[model samples]
Structures are given as C-alpha cells and as structure tokens.
Target chain A: MKPGTDWKNSYRANVFEEIPCGIVVIDRNLRIVDQNLAFTNIFGDGRGQTCYEVTRGRHTPCAECLAEQTFRDGQRRSREAMGVDPAGKPVHHLVQITPIRDETGNVPFVAALTTDLSATKRLQREYQTLFEKVPCYVTVVNRDYRVVKANTLFRKVFGEPTGEHCYQLFKRRHERCPECPAEQTFLDGGSHTSSHVGITRDGTAAHYVVSTAPLVQTDGETTHVIEMALDVTRLHRLEAELLRANALREALVENSPYAILILDQRRRVVLANRAAEKLWDCDRSTLIGHTLPRRAIACRLDEIVGRNGGPAPLVDSTIVTAKGVEIPVRLSGFTLHPVEGERSTAIIAQDLREIRTLEREKLDAERLAAVGQTVAGLAHGIKNILTGLEGGMYVTSGGLARHDEARVKQGWEMLERNIGRVSALVKNLLAFSRGDEPKPRLVRPAAIVADVVSLFKELAEQHDLVLETEISDVAPASMDAEGIHTCLTNLISNAFDACLVSHKPMCRVLVTLREENEEIIFEVTDTGCGMDYEVKQKAFTSFFTTKGSGGTGLGLLLTRKIVQQHGGSVTFESSSNEGTTFRLRFPRRRLPPPVEEEHNGS
Target chain B: MSREPSLHAPRVAIIDDEEDVLTFVRIALEDAGFTVEALDRPTEALATLEAFRPHVILLDLLMPEQMGVSLYTELRASPVLRDVPVIIVSGLNARDTLQEASAATGAGPPAGYLEKPVDAAALLDAVRRALSHSGRGTP
Candidate 1:
C-alpha cells in the first residue's frame, strides 16, 4: 500500500461523503468540476457541468456569486442562497465557498458547502404568526418594566411603544404600579396573574386580567417577562349592573309598610321587615333563623302555602306575642318557587287593633245619633199631646162660658180621651226607658203563643176578627217570659187596631210558633190595613202613631229592645191593603243562657 | 161664639188624624163664628173639601192614613181648592215642611202656619188672618 493512496481514501470517506452537507467543487468559469454524494442527491449528478446550469437551472452564472469572490480572493465566503434542483424546486440553504489551491498556491477551484435551512425558517414563521395574531395582548417586558416587544393586538390598543415602560403603555401611569404581577414574576421567576384597568389609545378604560411569566435565559436569570392580558370590559359592566339590581331589591324589601316575613321551606323565618318586628312584638334577631311557635301564627303552615295555588286568603285571627299577649291580626301568605334553590314562603300580617277600635267608635256614634233622634221624637209626641189638652181646655171653658150642654159634653169627652192618652204614654215611656237586662228562663215557645192568642181572643171577638193559633212541637229556649209576653201583647194590639181601621168586614189574625233551622220563630199575621211607603219607612224609627190618640208609638221599639236582649230579631212584611206579618226569630245558639237550677235538701 | 149654624159664617175645614184634635179644633172654629167641617180621615178629605168649598182650611201635617202634606198637594192641585187659603197646624215643623214641599212641587206656600199646642186665640187669629188674606173675610 502506498501512503498517498491511503490518505486520499481516508479524506473521501471521512470528510467528503460522511459530512451531512452537499459539497461541490467549481472552476473559476462557474463550472461544476466535482461533487459529493449529498450534492449529487440534491442537484442530480452534475459532473463536469456548469454550476449555474446544475444548481440554478440557468445558462448563466448567478448575479452575486460567492464562488467567484472565493476564486478571486482565494478566501472562504459564507452566505444564504436560494437555488433549485433538477426538478425546479427552490431550496433555502447556507453556503460556505472556499477556493481550492494548486501546488503553487494559485486559485484554481472553489469548494462550496451547503446546509439546508427550510425546516428552521418554517418554524420561525409559525412562531411569528402565533405571536402577532393571538386574541390576547401579549408583550415582552425587561427588568426596567419597559416593553421590549408587543403583539399586534397590543399595538392596536396602545399604539407603538418606543422603548416606553409597560406601565406607561398599559396604564398610562408615570410610575410603576403598586401591586404588579410582572415585578413578582421577575423576583420569583414564577408565573403570576393580576387584574388592572388600562387606558386604550382612544382614552377609554379597558378592564383586563394579565398573566405574567418570567423569561429565563440559559444563564437562568429572569431578564424579561411575557405578559398576556385578556380584555374583560363587557364582563365588568355586567357584574356592576347585577350588583346594582340586587341592592335595589334589598332596599324595596326593607322599606315596605306591610309586615313582611320570608320563611324557608322548613317554615323557619329567614328575613323579617321592620313592620313585621313590630307586629310580632319581638326583635328582628329573635325572629330570624328561628322557627315560629305553633301558637304564635295560630294556623297551619300547610294551609297557608297550599290554598288557592297562590296567596292564602286574608283571615281575621289572634296571634300570641312573645309575652303571651294576644293581638288581633289579618294574615295572608304566599309561596315562591325558583328554578334553582329552595322554595320559600312569605307571610304578610296586618294589625287589626286600630280597625277594631274604629269600628267600636263608629257603633258608639250611631247609638248616640239614635238616642238624639229618640229625644226629638219624644219632644214632638209631647207637643201633640199638649196641643190636644190645650184644645180640650179651650173647648170646655168656652162651652161653660156659653152655658151649652152638648158643647160641654163634647168638650168633656175630648178631655177624658186626651187624659187617658197621657197616662198610656207615661206607662209606655217607663217601660221603654227601663232598659233592664232580661232574666231568662227555659220556656216553651208554643205556650207563649197560646197565651198571646187567649189574651187577644176577647178583643178579636169584639172587633169581629177571626183570631187563630198555630203551635208546632219546638224545643224550649231560654227567654224572658214577661218581656216576650209584652212583645206579643203589643203586636196583637197593633194588629187589632190595623183590622179596625181596615174597614173590611172579614179580617183574620194568626199567631204561629214553630222551629226551623235551630231557630224558634213566632209570627203574628194579620189581614188588615197594611202600611204605606211613608208609614213603613217611619215604622221602627221614632214615635210614629197611626191610631189617632190610641198609639204611643213605643210598642214596636220596646219590643225590638226586648228581642235584642234575648238575642233575637224582629222582622216584618207589609203591603198596602193586603196584610202584615211580624216575625220574632230566635236562633237556638244565640238564646240567653238558662238560669241555674237550685235544689233544697230533703 | 156659639155652637149654632149660621148662614153668614165663613166656611172652614179642619183636617187631622186624631178625633179629639178634630173635635176641639172644629168646636173652637165654630165658636169663633165660622162654619167648620171636621175631617178625621185624610183619604176622604179631598172629596169633602171639594163639596164644602171652605173659605179656609186647617191642615195637620202628620197623619197615618195619608200624609197631610200630600193631601195639601192634592188640594193645591185641585181647581176649586187651589185658591183656598190653607193654615198648616201640626206637631211637626209645618213651616219648614211646607217650604221643602213647595221647593219640590213648585207650588206656593201655605197662607199661614200654626204649630201644635197653640192657644185658641192664636188659632182663631190665624184663621181670621188667612180668611182676610184670601179676600174672603167674614163680615
């Protein structure tokens, strides 16, 4: 083996073919003289061919050829060049050109080394696109809080930064922010996030959340920070509106005049207004979060929540306070069911103490007005009676002065009749003004009807009226016997007077006693002169007399008073020229309590 | 004044519900030299007054069978009795009632008013004045 031959073999094996680059040797005339395997694989076997034809697919050399410079200066030159393969596909590569020297050291050929860089350029383009078109405003900041680079979105919002601080661009602040996440990331070399209000180029505030990551180089020193800020202005506005609405609702519930209480599904009080506190006679703290006692509400919770498919009906009831005092109230309740969360019930209560007091006062006023009317009526009745007396005196004295017998007789009769009227009026007045409470005892209603019938029988016969009695089996009721008797007597007498004035030859009177619907009813029906509109309107009101000098007008009034005391009512039906019916109705439940029984020891 | 029928006496009508009131008022008017017709039932008063054609009428406002004011309305509406002078005598406030009735019916007021319990002289004086005011005074 020769020494030179071994060295050439080793050079081809180790340097020319084994290197991962395409190598080509070219003459000073831009012709390919020799090539490696990588060169042949890239340019497709270009032995003894012009370099421009093989690498550029051109008949002429490149405009700025580095191989010419290398051959002219006998020095190496490096550059990036775009060339094509035999298939006409362009390739990006870094090429280093060096002149090959002869034994005299004169420039003869140039060796060009090519490294393909297409994959690295594609990766660089992808990274730049991602950095420019991302949805967030991305920026790179240095240790001085200055913005070294900014993304497209950041430039659109804050304009171009000429080495300006990030605080100045993002927040338009002259000084650094007090609580900066970027500063924290720089110190700890960790990621951090914060929220801030930034000013856009148009001077509008932009709400954003910024996440900062420290950019540590190979030396592991955090020299820069990458900040990604997401715009949240619309979300911020929505949050503020929601808070305002919630505050308004709270204010409305707090200032309501009604006693409002909100209860959870378990019937525990959750919220109570000021009015509710006053009505329940308890503190707000005591009522809230506490289940009300059963006696306090005086009703079942289920009934209030289930009735009417909505709010419960208002009910007049009594509620016991914390102090065991009873308070009258009108109560109502409603339920609220939400799509999410527990269902609740709201109770509203109104204090009825003031209303009850007002009702009582109104009753008293009406009574006073009735009394005043009675006094006025009494005065008028007395005036008419006095008028009668005076007229009698006048006639009697005048007849005496004239010595006339028939005139004196007429005058004397008038005087006697008026005197009798006066006596009757006094008796009726005494009975009416007595106002004594009835001493009730158990008495059969039929017996009372029978007595009334018997008493009126004689008068009926005299007046040619057919008087009858109807008695049905009825239970005994507690009643004032004498008071009932007086009532019956007055009704019978009035019926008799009605018949006499009717001018009808045939008139009937019937007194009925019966039981109906747990009530004892005594009705006196008379076929007589019924009242007219004017008379009926004034019938039960005052001293209205229709029987000339016979009626004192206190009969029905006294009857009504007695009936009221016995917890009964008197009603009448009358029509002109037809008849009249006076009904005395006594409900069994409303009758006075029976007198206590006493027994003597034997 | 005496209880004798006189042809020259001024005719008078006394309307009341009470028999005693009618009797006394009639007697008093008759004693005062007037021919009087006493009416106990107001339902019958219109026919009687139309027949008697009295120079003066004494009306009681309150009555059971019919209101005297209603009867007064009929009298004032009557062709013959409309011109007759009516003196209201009642236990009620007859003047106020007449005014109220007049306001409603658009009729003229009564010639005179006398409340109940009036003296005989006052009643006679009222009748006389009414008769005089109506141009039918008794000579």
Candidate 2:
C-alpha cells in the first residue's frame, strides 16, 4: 500500500471519473486523446477529434493554443476560455495544460484538465452588472489622483476618464481640490467623506457628497482610493430655498409696525421684535427667555394657546411698561406651528394711547364749540331782558312825569315780569354752564322714567291728557341717575305744554321704556301741538323758545347735555299740529362707568 | 316830550313777539304825537299793518311761529305796504342781522338797524327819522 502507486490507481478509478470538472488529453497533432466523464458530459465524447473541434466545434486547431505551447516546451499553461457545449449553449471553463512525456522526454502529448466555471462566471457577470448600473458615480483612483477605473454611471456623467485625474474629470479643474477626501484616504488608508460641486457633461454644476475608501495592498500600503459619490444637487437646491424663505419671514417679523412677541410652549418669550422692545420700554435681551411684560398680555397669550392655529380677535387691554407706566393697547394673538408637534404663541399689541388722546381732544373741541354757541345765545337773551327793562324805565318815568296812574301801573307790571325773567335766565345759565362729570351709578332706566312720569301725571290729568306708561322689565345700567331724571322731566313737561297748546279736549301722552341690542331705550309720544318749520329749525339752538316769556330756552339744552354725559343721544320727530315723539337711546357698553362707592360717599 | 296829535300825524306800525316791547314802542310813538299800531304776533302783524297803513313799520328779527325776517319779506311783497319804511330791531347784532335778512330775502336793507335795549329816546328818534325819510313826518 505505497502512497504513490495507490494514488495513481485511485486517480483512474475514482479521482478522474468522479471529479466535478471536465478533463481531457490532447496530442501534438491537436486531437483529443482521452476525456473524463465530466468532460464528456460537457463536450459529448471528443475521442478521435481535435480539442478545438470538441470544445469549439472548429475544424482547425485554435490559434494561441495553450496545449500546443505545452507540447513544444514541455511546460504547463492555464487560461480561461469560452466555447459551446453539446447542446451548443455557451460554457465557460478554466483549462490547465501540462506536457505528458515518454521515457525519451521528447515529442510528447499534453493533458488539459478543464474545470467548468459557468456558474462562477455567471455570478461574476451579475456582480459586474450591479457595479456598472449603480445610481451614483463610482471611480477608482491611483495614488497620483488619476482615475484608473470608473463605472458606467461615472463614464456617462463625467465622460470617459481613461487616465484623467479625478479632479479634472469630475470638477473640470486642472488642479486638485484643496480638501480632497481621496487624498486623505490615500494618506491614512482610512475612509473619508466630503461634499463637492462637480461639472457634468452638459456643463452644469452637480452637487455631490463623495465617500473615499482606501484600496489597501497586502502589505498594508495605501495605493489607490475608491470614491462613491451621491448626487445631492436637488437637496442642496431645496435647502437654499428653505433658507431664503426663513430669512424673509424673519425680516417681516422684525420690521412690522405692531409689536410682535413669540412665546414658546412653556409661555417663555423666545423672540421679541424691535417694536416689542420699544413698546415695553425694555431691551430684547431683557425680554428674551422671560414671560410676558404684564398680566394682561400673559392672560391673552394663555387664552390663545388653548385655541390652536387661528388668530384671536383683538381685545382692549392695558399694559404696564418697564417704567411702570400704564398704556392702553389693542391686543391680538395667534397660535403658530413652526414645526411639526411644536407650538408657539404670537402676540401683536397695538398702542392706543395716541388714538385715545386724539379722541379726548376732539371731544374737548366739540365741547368748546358748544360753549361758544351757548355764550352767543346768552348774549341775545340778556339783550332782550335789557330791552324789556329799558322799556319799563321809559314808561315809568314818562307816566310819573304826567301823573298817569294807569300808565304807571302798566310800566310797573312790565318791570316785575322782566325781573322774574332775569332771575330765571340766570338760574338756567348757571345750570347749563356747570360742566361737571356725570355721577354714574347702577340704576334702572325704567325707574327714572316712572319718577318723571309720576311728577307730571297730575298736571297731565288736569290738562285733560291721557298719560300712560308701556314699560318692559329692563336691566339696570351704569348712569347718572339725577341727570336722567332731569332729561325725562324736561321731555315730559314739554309734552304737557304741547298738549295744552293743542287745545284738544282729549290728548294722549305715552312713555315707554325697553331694552334692545344691548341698549336702553326711552320714548315719549305726545298728541299735542307740534313745532312748525321755523320752530323745528331752531329747536336745539341757543335761546330759541316757542314759549315766549315762559321759557328760558335752557331746558332742551340741559337735557341734551345730560344725555350726552351718559353716552346717550336725544332725537325727536315732530309734525306740526300733529304730535311729537322724543327718543333717548343709551347703549349699555357706552354708558358711563359706575362711580366708586368711596368717592360717592365722600 | 308831549306833543299834540294831529290828523296829519305820521302813522307807525310795530311788530314784535315781546308784548312789553310792543307796548313801550306804541306809547313812545303816541307820546311823540305819531299814530301807532302794535301787534305781538308776526302772523297777525302783516294784516294789521296793511289795515293801519302806517307811514313807517318796526319789525323784530326773532319771533316764534314765524321769523320776523320772513314777515318783513311778506310785507315788502305787499302791494300797499311795500312803500312803507321798515326799521329792524333785534337782540341779534344789528348790522349782521340786517345784512343776513337782506341777503336771505334778496331785498334792500331796512330803513334803520337798532340792536335791542334801545332806549325810548333812541326809539323815538329812529321812528321820526324813518318817518322823515319816507317823507311822511308830522308837520
């Protein structure tokens, strides 16, 4: 059982027959001398035929035949070859040819041991396809920074770079990029990544992120680098657009006229604009990372945070600045979502101090104008009284000189009448000129109407006028109670006079009180002699009276003043010889605020 | 200032809303020997004025029910009274009231303007001057 002899017998019986790869023997004449089963299975029995005829179905010996070289030099040779099988299907194999010599060691045959490599070749082909068809640019560069190899996508994007430097092929630059990742990989034999702008075949810029990996030799020497570059031009464009939009938004917020405050979810001020700092009389550094300036703004922000996404209506509020000065402001709020799942609240405050001041000045100007008009009317009234006094003096003196008793009595009567008128005029003037703020209290409007009505009820009855009330239950309001009483009394007394002047046997006076549209309304209707065109034209003017010698002409004026103080209006409709209806409308919201009890007590 | 009334005494008409003014003017004119008619209401003054056929007319600018300016305009339009000299007496400013009345009525200014508190002497003087201006003074 010697090893060498046993192996030769085993090789014929088992090794050669059972081997998975194809094997064949050929002579110097280029004929197939012997073949293994694996070879027969592939080429289908090639005995008595040339090796090229069995493997390639060729009639002549193949050019550059490895077995012919082995037979001439008595050496061994190997090569990978492609041929057709029994079924004419493509086969790939690796052949090893060794010379088989006789005892003389000259002019010998060769055995070509073939290994079927069709499956391995198929796998290699698939891998090659994958490498070429990858979406990104792949390049293999040598130590000199030249692209030794490139993939299909690289060739298409950068144009075939046979021996061109990677920088020149990818960036169209004659010099290497300063921060080249491939150079770093070559230095350290480690992977590196960097972003670059490459030029495409179409002469357009292509943004890419390139990763460089060292292709190290067995000796651990870094010779070349493999670069995998992902095109990110679209992502870069998107990022640039987003940056522009963010910058524009920031500019708008900073330059807005109204004060803007952005509060994070924790109700801390994350951002405050220049206007906000100015309004609060503070610096942005002081405001940032802090809560709202005052309770008013904080309360509004809290309320808006509850209502996600939309804007809150503007509300009148008061804020205290850093210097402790209270200012009126109109506040509006919005809930903003700058990012998903993150919430913020924005408050916009509009300063109303200037507007309030303007309104007050306008009111003062109107009041001054009214006072001027009233003074003119006062002059006219005083002159008329003076004329009456002068007439009395002239008649009394004339009658006394003549000793005419009847004329003297007549002149004395004139004097008395004028003196009484003067007293009345002075009293009414004092009342009209008393420009005091209203004393507001919580009182029922209907009660004031009822009080005035009751005061005039007996007079109305005596005048044969049917006086009635149509009062509905109404809410109490903040108002000047005595002022309202005076207004009602003036209106009702005028109604009685109108009825008397009508000379009608039966006259009706109706007073009604109601509430509607958040306003209190009182209306008085009289079936009495109404104003003519001239009387109506001068109804609200100074010292213009229908009741000559009886009216000081201050009743309507005082009533109007009182109504205006209560933030109410007086309007009347009258038709000559028919009737007059006067309306007093008071909106609840506009009514004067209630006076504090302490002040009232004082 | 007593004078005897004669048949040729200049007749004067006074229209005013104030009864005291009307009475005083009437007595003053009567004592000066001019025949006078005084009416308190402007509504009645026009008819009474036409009936009295006064040589001069006195009008108050402000009156209830109707403005005296309008009454004066009506009197000017009256065929019989259009020639009578009309004087304006008002509590308002005399020149302004007269100008306003003249502008509003599109008529000539009144014979004289008198702001109120006008005394008896001034009233008599104004009346006599108006009568003379109309060429109807008592001889």
On lDDT, the leading prediction is 1
lDDT of 2 by residue, A148-234 (tens): 888998888677787999888888899999999998988888899999999977888989999999875557888888898999999
Candidate 2 residues lying further than 4 Å off, grouped into runs, are: A1-257, A260-328, A337-341, A431-485, A499-508, A511-522, A532-542, A561-569, A585-602, B1-8, B43-55, B68-86, B94-101
Lowest lDDT block of 10, candidate 1 chain A: A302-311
TM-score of each: 0.61, 0.56
Q: Per-residue alpha-carbon lDDT of model 1 for B1-139, expressed as tens digits?
A: 4657688889999998877778778877777778989988899889989999999999998898799888988888999999899998888876777788876887789998898878888988998888778778563
Clashes of each: 0, 0
Candidate 2 local Cα displacement, residue A389, angstroms: 1.8
RMSD of 2: 10.8
In candidate 2, how many Å is residue A191 off?
30
Q: For residue B98, what is the lDDT in candidate 1?
A: 74
* Per-model B-chain TM-score: 0.93, 0.89
- lDDT string for model 1 (A1-602, tens) is 69999998989677897687899888888788888888888888988888888877888788888888877788888988888988888977889998789999988989999887667778879988998999999999999999999999989877887899998998889999999999999888999999999987788999999999987554777999999999998899899999999899778778776688889987789999888888888999999999978898887766555465754788778778888889898887888787999989888778889999999999999989989887877777887788888878887888789897777777788788888888988899898988788878898877887887897778788879999888999887898888999999989888888888999999998888888899889898899999999988888876888877888989999999999988899999999888899999988899889776656744
Q: Record all residue pairs in model 1 with backbone atoms less than 3 Å apart, i.e. clashing.
A: none
